[model samples]
Each structure stands twice: as structure tokens, then as C-alpha cells.
Target: MQSFLSKIKDFNNKHRKIAPFIIWIEIILIFLASIMKNICRHYKILLAVVVVLIVIGISARHLASVESKTPEEGSVVAASEEMSVVEEALQEATVEASNEASGEESLINVDSAVSETSMENVDSAVSETSLENADAAASLESTASLYVDSGISEFIKAHTEAVGWIKFEDDLISYPIMQAEDNSKYAIEDADGNDSETGAIFLDYRSSADFSDSNTIIYGHNMRDRSMFGALKNYKEDLGFLDDHKYFQIITPEGSGRYMLFAFMDVPKNSYIYDVCGDNTSRMREFLDTIEYKTYIDTGIEPTVDDKIITLSTCTQKDDLFFVMFAVKVDD
Candidate 1:
């Protein structure tokens, strides 16, 4: 009996890590059964009760472990609700800002109307008034661009490896594009070096950080959550999605610019479009021609060899297939 109890104790200790509470409950029930057998005449009843308790305890533990591993439906709903609340708040704030801007513009127009009347009264002022208004509008646009660049610079200061920010007009593709010594650094890791399935959008390892390359390549994961570059698949579902979202913006420390999307295609994993350094004007034109041919829809925007281009690539439904979108930088 001593030898048998010793072996049972060893077994319990070995499996304690896997199910601590269940092991402890089994031990207590067995001890109680042993005591009940000693006190009562019937040992079979106590033995059966202990066996039932052990089975129930083990089954409950197994169920609990499975539940812990699976994601809860309620949690997903809560997250989506929070995101909707945030988006709604942002939309309301944007509408308020637009109303305020309209109010300011109306006041400016009133001032301009009074000034025009004065200019009409004075023939000398009429000659230079239109030019002055043009100059002021240009200055305002320049100042706004400068302010946006400054904000991006401030963001880069906090995240040194961040090369630039990219955002598609009507998609959830807004993310900071990062580059490291190797492309694999951000392939499975975020900007903060945390392991993530949907990693940060990253520039190609061979591409320049300053966006000086002929064809800059950016990559992101096509997450099932519709995050990262997952929304890119919408183009395949609705061809008009491309027509509605023709432009994406990239803001660098140097300046901010827009890119007009001209083509989207699915290519093999080893396609030449992944080549960053081997591109020349002739090669780029050939590459553009191939993209134009493979594109699902003709955007009617053609690119010249001199224009700088960007390619956003992500995996498609197949592991070996890659979906890529090509766009040319629009001259500011």
C-alpha cells in the first residue's frame, strides 16, 4: 500500500503543472474515499464516488483550457464597437472643423467684397488686386504643406526607423512605413519590435529611405481582420473600388506628395517587380507595360519613365501569389 501510494503521489506531482486544481481535487477525493472505506462497511460506494469526482474534475479542466485558448465572440464585438465609436467621434469633429472653416471663408469673402468695391472706386488699386489674391492663396497652401511636413518630422523623431507615412484615400491603409537593415525585421514585427501577425508596413530592404529610388516598394500583411494591406483585396471584389480610390498620399520629412494609382496585378512570389536596385528607365517602362497588361482595370493614367513610382505588395489568397498595386508620384 505504501509503495502504491508513493507511485500515485509521484504521478500527481508530475501532472500538477498541467492541471493543478484538478490534481489537488483528485488527491483529496481519494484520501476521503480511503477514510470512508476504513469507517464504513461498504468500500464500493466510496470508490465509485471518488472515480466520478475525478472524471468530472478532469473534464472541467479540459473544457476550461479549451475555452481559454479560443477567442471570445463578445470580445471581438466589443473591440468593433469601440472602433466605431472612435470613428464616429472623428467624423463629428471633422464636420465641426469644416463648418468653422466655412465660416472663416465667408468672412474672408466679405472682406474681399469690400476690398473689391474699394478697388472699383480707386482705378489704381484694380490693376494689382487679382494678383494679390492669387499670391495670398498660394502662400496659404504652402504654409499648410509646411505644417503637415513639420508634424511628420515630429512623428519621425519619436520613431527614428519610420521612413514615411502612407495612406490610401478610402481604405484602412494608413500606417507608418518603416525600414531596417533587412526587410525581414518588420515582416513579422511591428515598429515597436513586438511580434505581430499584421506587421508594420515596411519599405524594401534595397530601397532608399528618402524615396529617391526609381521604384520604391512597400510591403504589408494581408490580415484577415481587414487591417494592414487587407483592404487591398477590395479592388478584386469591386473593380470600382480602384476608380473611387485613385490616389494615395505619402508624407516624408522632406515633404508630402500624392501618388496616382494606375495599375494593380497579382504576380508570383518571385516576380521581377520585387527588384529594387536593377531598375532603369527602359526596364521601368517595360515593367510598367507588364503591369498595365495584367491590371484588372485600366485607370487611363499612363506613366513616363522619368516619373518615380511606388509599389504596394501583399500576399493574395495563395501563398505563392502576391497582389501588387502600382502608382506614380504626382508632380506637386
Candidate 2:
């Protein structure tokens, strides 16, 4: 005990700057020791006091750690809500002060720096959210373009003029339709805009791309290899083919359309059926009448001016002759 007291005295004298704190701790230790010695006979009471002091110290440290932690990013909105709660607390405090002081008003001060920082954080969050939304929308559009029908997607990627696709339900004909400033480009060029004898099927330059016109014309070559519109000749050879294979699907970027075969016959290159795509209602009536008069076999389906018609045209062996098939928008 004497040697320990000598060491403590030496430490206090060596570090004079912290000597007062050391002396205070020493005094507290002595006081506790005196109490412990006096209460040594009551062992249960002494143990309970020590445990209580340890618990209080641990709780104080835990509370300080919680209070010292900084808020995370995106927590500004939550912090703003907490600020509202703080304002409510201050209002309550003011009310209590008034009640205690017989209606005397109490001034409450809020830091301007804290309010400005919160506003800036809110603005930053909104800007970041908007940028994220824009990036997501761009990604969705790119993904959708990637997911287009593989054949059509390749055609468009290779040739910008490629417009849509035509498919018969019975698998008679399937081809990509191209459009240009004029109809003759596709008549000699393939879907990839390369020069080929078996040229691509193409839409009329004068008609609306969405097929909203009263009459729309799509032309393809009747190849001997049975590609392109070569299978269309099957309907003419056996009129019975129309009984089951009447519907053809036209798929565009906008949507798809199912058309039922209503007429098929040979027409001149300058036929009036080609002129019905415009806004002239009288011409459309004449066109329908001509179709009824000139169709090869009566399918019992007569289309009116209110309905839309799509015409598939191909060249015959003769120079001036063209085989044509007329289908009305049956699905509409």
C-alpha cells in the first residue's frame, strides 16, 4: 500500500497539467472505498449499488453513440418530417411557457442555416430522381426496339426504308414491305435496298403508312421459286383455296391488321382501283362497284366505303397484265 501510494504521488507530480483531474478521481475512489468498508456487513446492498452504477454508465454511452451518428443520403425527406415534429414540440414548449408565466409570450428561434440546407437537399433529391426516370425511359425504348420481330428488326437495321411485314395465316406468303419516295425503288431493290430480281414487297408511296387510307396497295414479285408473292397464284388456280386461307396479317410498327380475301382478279396496270386511296368518296363508290363487277368468284362478302381495303398486286407473264387480290379489314 505504501509503495502504491508513492507511485501515485510520483505520477501526479510528473504530469502537473492533469494533476487536478487525477486528484478528483483519487478522492472519489477513496469515498467509494470508505462506503464499501462501512457497508461490508451488508453485502447484498453493496452489490446492488455497483450493478446500478454500471448499468447507468452503459446506458449513457449507448445514448451518446446514437445521438452522434450522422444521417444517411436520401434521409433528407425523413429529416424534414422530423423538423416538422420539432416545430410542433417548440409550439408546445411555447404554450407551456405561456401557461406558467401567466400568458407572457415566449420567442422561439430556428436556425436559418438548417432550413436552407434542408431545402437544398430536397432540390438535389428531385433532380436526381428526374434524371433516373429519364434514363429508365431511354433504356426501355432501346430494349423495346431490340425486342422487335427478329426478321423485321434485321430488315430495319439493314435498311431504313423497310416499313412493315406481311404474313398469310396459312403460311402462303411472308415478306417485309418497304416504302420509299417512289414505288419503283422496291420493285428492283430488295428489303436491304440491294438490287435483286426477286425484289421486296413494297407499299404504295401515295398511301398512308399506317394503312388508314380507303385503299392501300402493296406489290410483290411472283417468283418462280415460290417465294415473295409466288404462292398468291394458288388462290387463282384453286378458288377453293379461299375457303380456308382467306385471312392475311399485316404487321406494322403501329399494330397488326387481319384482312379477309374479298376479291382477286387480273387488272390493268392503270386500273381505277389504284385511285381510291384519296379522300374522294364518289371515286371510292365506283371502285367498290368495279370490284364487285370484276372479281373472279363471288365470296359473298361485299365491302363498303366505310371499311378499309388492302390490295396485293403482282405482275403477270404478260406485259400489261397484273394479278391482284383485295382483302377488307375483317378484324376491325
Top lDDT prediction, candidate number: 2
Question: Where is model 2 more than 4 Å wrong at Cα?
Answer: 1-158, 278-281
Candidate 2 TM-score over all chains jointly: 0.53
Q: Any residue pairs clashing in model 1, and if so which?
A: none
Candidate 1 Cα lDDT to native: 0.68
How close to the true structure is residue 322 of candidate 2, measured as C-alpha lDDT?
A: 82
Worst 10 residues of 1 by lDDT: 119-128
| 1-332: candidate 1 lDDT, tens digit per residue | 99999999999888878786877899999999988778697677788999999999999999999989977899988887768646534533443354355532111123333111121111111111123333432343344345344577865777789888886765346777889888777776666576544557889878888887789899877643446676676776667877678788888888777888888888888887676442344578787788778888887888877788999988753446788888899954
TM-score of each: 0.54, 0.53
lDDT of each: 0.68, 0.69
